[model samples]
Target: MAELIDVLLFAFLLATAFYVLLSRDLLAVVMVAGIYSLLSAGMFLVMDAADVAFTEAAVGAGVSTLLLLIALTATGRWEKPAGHRVVPLLVVLATGATLVYGTLDLPPIGKPDNPPQVHVAPHYLERSGEEIGIPNVVTSVLASYRGFDTLGEVVVVFTAGLGVFLLIGGPRRRRGGEK
Candidate 1:
């Protein structure tokens, strides 16, 4: 049943992606992108990645969609045509192919003997409470072991929000038009 839901969600995501790519209407594209993000959040939920799903729902579906809609309101609703697509198309195909090829080298999902499980996971699970003094292993890993990475992610999200704010024309003018 879970696998069936995953497949359906994946299919919906693919269809939404294609629609977003083919549609020239910016509003329609933004709406479909939100749908894609929602499907992604659902997929993460089904995979038991609640934290990731929450981020996807909040950042991807919520913030990103709102920003895009705001930007669309400021800009034209139609996308301008490009002069050349061949180079961009080639680049996209190459990147997609490389990603698919790279995934082939990944260990199968839930494989107990995988490198992370064999090496890093055990150390974290056993010593995290002792070293970091955090009862929850996930919190320990994110807060202590992977602190820099988590900080980097937070910084990126903050930067993106700042960019959106700048794009949306900042704060409203005062009654006296003071700077």
Candidate 2:
């Protein structure tokens, strides 16, 4: 049943991705992007990463969708037609092939013999209580072990949001294009 749900969610995500690529309406694309983020959040939840799922729902679906909608309101709702370019298509195909090939080498999920499980997991499980003094290993891992990484992620998100808001809401120049 869980596998079935995963397949269904993956299929929906694929369909929405194709729709977003093919649709010319910017508004529809934004809506589908929001849906994609929601499906991603669900996938994260199913994978047992509740914190990641919450962040995806809040930042990906909520803030991103609102920003895209605001952008559309400031600009136009319809995408202008563009001439087909072969280089980008080739690059995308090459990158996708590389990613698929790379994934082929990954260890199966939840395997105890996996590198992280064998190495990092034992260390964290054994020493987290003494080292971090946190009862919850997960909390210790996130807050103490990987605190810098988490802080960096937060800083990046805040900067990106501020940059986008500034770009959209910044003062407009006169018709003469003066500063």
lDDT of each: 0.90, 0.91
lDDT minimum window of 10 residues, candidate 1: 167-176
lDDT by residue for model 1 (1-179), tens: 99899889989999999999999999999989998999999998998888888889998999989989988999989999889999999999999999999999999998999988898899999888789886778778898899999999999989988997896556665644874
Model 1 stretches astray by more than 4 angstroms:
129-136, 157-179
The pairs that clash in candidate 1 are none
User: What's each prediction's TM-score?
Assistant: 0.81, 0.84
**lDDT agreement of model 2 with the native:** 0.91
TM match of model 2 to true structure: 0.84
Local error of candidate 1 at residue 61 (angstroms): 0.3
Q: In model 2, which regions exceed 4 Å deviation?
A: 129-136, 161-179
